[model samples]
Target: MRPNHSPEYVQSDNSLDVAPPYFFPNVDVQGFVIEADLKAVQKYCDDFLNLGTREERGFEYRAVPAWPFAQLLFLHYPVMISAAPDVVKGGNGRDSENPIPSSNPDFIVPMADRGTTSQNEVFAAIPVMRYGVGPKGLLVESELEWILPFIVVDQPWSCVCGREMLGLGKMMSRIDIGPGYLPGSFLGEVHMPGWDGNSPEMQHDLPFLYVQTGPALPTFRATEPLKSLATAFQAKPVRWALEKIAGLSNFVDDASLGLVPTTMQTVALKQYRDAVDPECAVYQALVGCRSKYSEISNLDFYDERDIWVMFNYVGSFREAVDVILGDELKKPLVVYPELDKTVSITGRMAKVVGAFKFSANVDFDDMRVLHEFDIRKDRKEGGHGQVLKRGSSDLTARWFRPLKGFFGPRPMP
Candidate 1:
């Protein structure tokens, strides 16, 4: 909105000088200022007034970027104007079938499309059994392990998109360790906060730590191709976008532990896989890493299977295990993309939708005393003496101690 009052013009040595509070006050409109594009500013003002209306709402408004810029501009010179509520609501409308609405005065405002770019790629977490050099040049088969899904993207946010486009879920909850003396006992008692009987103050018995492995690959749904090619392209951008929104570091500590895959390696692997299998089918294109499972009751003493054994021994451990191993232990953890499920992408941006599934078994032998209570006086006074006399469960002078304090002394029976 332009100001109603006009500023006085004065004659300067070279040209006419406008006084304070000139039209478009505080805005540098000098012709010599080459950076200022008057046409663009005028269009923005016109659009602000006319575009966000009931009849013809603006498309591709890019609100993600535009809103902050508009706020900065408004901060300098506050303006208040009232118009139709739908006018300010732009981009793809609520319903996919009718993204943009016609002129309905009572039309409901739909969720705006996130005006950011995104990419897509296939991802999988397979159990790999491989041989590696041990301490004395002897090759040993690496313990049975599942590789966390590795994602890469030109934009870090797209990493999330690529994972999602491949149909992986979000991360599992933070792992909780319970007080225990042995690694096997520690594994068996490990639980997550908010789980049925676990609490934050419950300290782990052994020295141990665990981290989430980013988002997890989905298990229930059958494997299928990603919804669209555009979605596939958004994979990298989506990951970075998520990194920006929610710190990716919070999900996993990649720097300390070399668990997360490198960006270059992930990209290279996807390219190789896609090139070998152009169809881009998740299951057909990806190689399955064979997983071996031993029943909890039959595991060895020092094997990782100790976790399974401990888990079976304590029924409380079932909740966390069920999240990773699925409701039924008989079912193997399977990851595959689903073409039927799709996330809305805007300008390479998409919201993280589901939770991830992560499984980690921590084992350390070190022990620490958490808390202690003084019971020497109680022991000497027989405070904890068992009631062996055959009488009704009633108070008796022989089983009780009388108080001797400054207030008063009591006689013993």
Candidate 2:
């Protein structure tokens, strides 16, 4: 239940003297300095800040199409940490209704995550996507959230037959990439708000699309919008979560080579479909892009189809983009979010809940309150805070901060 964080992790290069009297006149999280390891975040910020110039979109990460999205998996990041056990123990066998984390490669802590202010809810991840150019800057989409769900096993290997991890029902969906953004959009958008107008990284760019589960969307569309069948199943993991991950690990090796034949299920799907039509394929080839199928296939499922169609559709759709790109429809540049190595440094890789940069501009009240403007519309332990969107002109803006910039569209069910 304790936070899996350390003082060294807190030592950030961006660490302002929030330690007291000398902090910014109206700085947010005043007095409390960011982790001293602010350099990771600072570098991440700087890279994007210099987005869209000769070195970026024009040349691509390494002069490759999908490289931007996949290449940045080498940066150091300080992410939020959480345990997969907490997610499983938080509810029934299939009730993976946990709030989405703000970042990836984060640590999930049970009791220590409480936050009286938005800034207190910091998470971690190496921002892998490059900001690209778009209509205004980068074409920011709606909200789409993603979450990885699983139940670990003590010793059972996931690749075994009939293992929940190896079968069809062992996965969950968290975020969905939308239609507009290409693979390199993240870096493209960096220049939108006049983002480093003359940075070397800037060039024509492509952006990846995804739905945001910004904690504000009315409903989640990534899955089959949980059924209204009014049926409650047992809470035990008939199929363990970790078992499935092990199974999936064997399927694909590189994220860019597309998904590999890992489990009997995915393997079977490929086989069966191929058998049915030696040429025409139903399950499209997995794009080297980092879609969630790799993550979803590892969850323990209650209702199998919900997760199935979600990933199936997402992968298929992204494949279509490849087809478009092949037609010489190549945008000036494209970017997909990549995970920097700020991970590996953490204990056991964990879920990211939040991450921020520059400084959070929260307003304190006369009573030194985080905010006097709004209340947590619905406070459910382990559930989620009613998060506001990036540009929601509503009252929720003051209640939450848009650290992720509300990119892509909201996820579909």
Candidate 3:
């Protein structure tokens, strides 16, 4: 065998960036639950998260609409930072002094004067169905899995690191949030670089997304310490009521399915476009990641009547939003009454099912490759779309070895 390469030696001089096991110590989140059209959600899952055929196993990943709604969440980090502990102790062949770039604070955005403004992001979480065949040839659906189709972040470093490292497809945008636009409420807008006309010369920053929190009704704030935002909104009665409104009361279980609790589990499509052929992908994969929150406090719920969420049909962003949510700008379920003469809502506003806010210590870790797409042929055209099977499970004993004893006998190698 050839001599093992030194960890201190740069793996690739062309790409010298942060390595994974990323962590975020502080994260403030504001979430809004929107009742979405079921058909739209289904189409999105089929188009993006569809797991193609495996000729040998005779089993493939499939997506069905779990719930007819989406979660629009805004995350603002007060002291945004990243660290790579694996490289610091010289575990991966690198010396302690020659650590990865992430050993230093790769991205640091100090809290603004008013708080929650330095690093901001807005994303939509529409849970797609993940099912597999069981031993008895029965389909078992995993409700905990979902796909994140849309996300925009302000920090450039965050955008690069998130996409390259964790497979978080984050776009660069100017995200503004917090009070001032609406009294006793929060307002958020995502300004992305796009064109007003048909040419690149017209490209400029345009606010295509708008979300405003109306003042909540005199609801009591839960002071008790909580685990996550999902737990805070885990009231069965409320969830069941919302499900009933969506005509899913009969199909869903009262205990689960309606409102997923804590540790948000999600999947993302990570891909790199070919340098020679922009249409073809060099590498593509479906990555599974979990966002677990701890030390959650100051959880407060809002009356649905008080929250407003809307998306614009910009030519650039419509392909992404409309493919999932339908023609939002032209078609709308409810039209807001003419309150401000200047403001005209051409796009659609989602029916707010639930709204909440909380503070927590979030960790953006726990990620692994769930599936990888064959990039030889174009997947979009329905060609060579099989998933590459892994030879063995990707687990290291140093971490999970202790827990193995707690379980039954280990599997024979």
Candidate 4:
């Protein structure tokens, strides 16, 4: 790879010859050269090719060849600096309560009229540089400079630079959180040109690592049911509520489904705990379900069906109760109720109601999961094959394994 170099600035009439803010390359080229073996290189290429093409929400795209390697590098290395809490602190000066405030008016730069200075303000910043193959098997680098600060005030979840960084001008597209390489984690995906520029016919749906604690606020809001679930079960209550409501008949066993047996209380409690408790088998199954969805989205496109299904299941439960009892079952019902009015004071029903309410307010498009990506263990274990000896001269000529087969099925000449 070419050694990291600072940008040269041209003298201007009003401003001194100042270099534009450039994102520094974060990958250790010499380390990659020494550590990467043929098997590892081949696996990286295969993973990229396996992504193939994807179509979602009427948009078609593919994964760039360098995407896998880049993802691995960013996740495993300390390339990204987590945004300080103060950097994204809300206007009220609270750390996690409010949305990040816009930059000061004096610091705002005027560009093409976006109609608001908030859109022009900078909030949280992440500098990224991509590595790929060049002509003559040389490693080339490209900087995502314009896409630095991910603004929060005007457009909460969108990158301020948007498609301008891709040289595609302004587009309706916005960057969003998607399934990550690991379960219970998320990554950022956007539609852009491939690294090689080979696929002019189709855009690449590239995925990259982002700082989890960045300026962007979560799109999904936790509802009462979700809160109750977390409080009662310390797990995803919305998912649990949906499952319980979907299989209401199995638990209640009533033709009208209005009456529930008080004796089944132990069974119901076990079922809920089994599904939500991290130590239980059903909890692993839930995690597996999330992992499977992530795998599917990586191969195809991000699908909202799974999320919608959870919400739909909850709605169906609500409808069933309303039809059978002629009254709304405001909470999720997992077991039969006791006739004793004193039992109602135990707050079990409140938890159920919260879960049901959470389902109704669930925003399928706003879901995200956390993935912990750290390779310190691998380094400690000395799993990085053979690394080259470090020296000043050796660092200058850093090399990276050529990523072949990036462009899928090149047309025959």
Cα lDDT listed for each candidate? 0.22, 0.21, 0.58, 0.21
Model 4 lDDT tens row, 246-352: 33434322321211110110000001123333332221000000000010001011111111101111212222112212243344533222224343221112111
Q: What order do you get sorting by TM-score, best first?
A: 3, 2, 4, 1
Question: Which is better, 3 or 4, measured by lDDT?
Answer: 3
In candidate 3, residue 357 scores what lDDT? 67
What value does the lDDT take at residue 71 in candidate 4?
Answer: 10
Off by over 4 Å in 4: 1-6, 9-413
Better of 2 and 4 by TM-score: 2
Please identify model 1 stretches exceeding 4 Å from their true place. 1-112, 115-146, 149-165, 169-260, 263-413
Please report how far candidate 4 places residue 308 from its true position, in Å. Answer: 3.5
TM-score of each: 0.16, 0.17, 0.69, 0.16
1-413 in candidate 3: lDDT tens per residue? Answer: 21253244333223424555445655777878877666666566666656455432223344454567777888888765444443222333334685334444332221111122248888888766554345422222233466677889988767876787678888888898887354557778777887544656767786667788765433333354544333444465654454344223223224334442346667777778878778767776767777766655444455566667876655576666664466544454343332232554445566677776656677667677666665544555756545432221222222344666565586554
Please give the lDDT score at residue 387 for candidate 1.
30
Number of the predicted model whose lDDT against the real structure is largest:
3
lDDT of 4: 0.21
Rate residue 232 of model 1 by lDDT. 29
1-413: candidate 2 lDDT, tens digit per residue: 22243122232223211111111121211010011122332333333222223332221111112211110110111221211233222233222564644343242332223211111111111222322234322233111111111111111111121122122111111222222232211111110011112445533322222212121111133234434211111122322333344235433333213212111111101111335445522222100111121232322112212110100112222322222122132223222233233521111111112211111112111111111111122322322356321111111111123533364354344
Worst 10-residue lDDT window for candidate 2 reads 184-193
- Give the Cα RMSD of candidate 2: 27.5
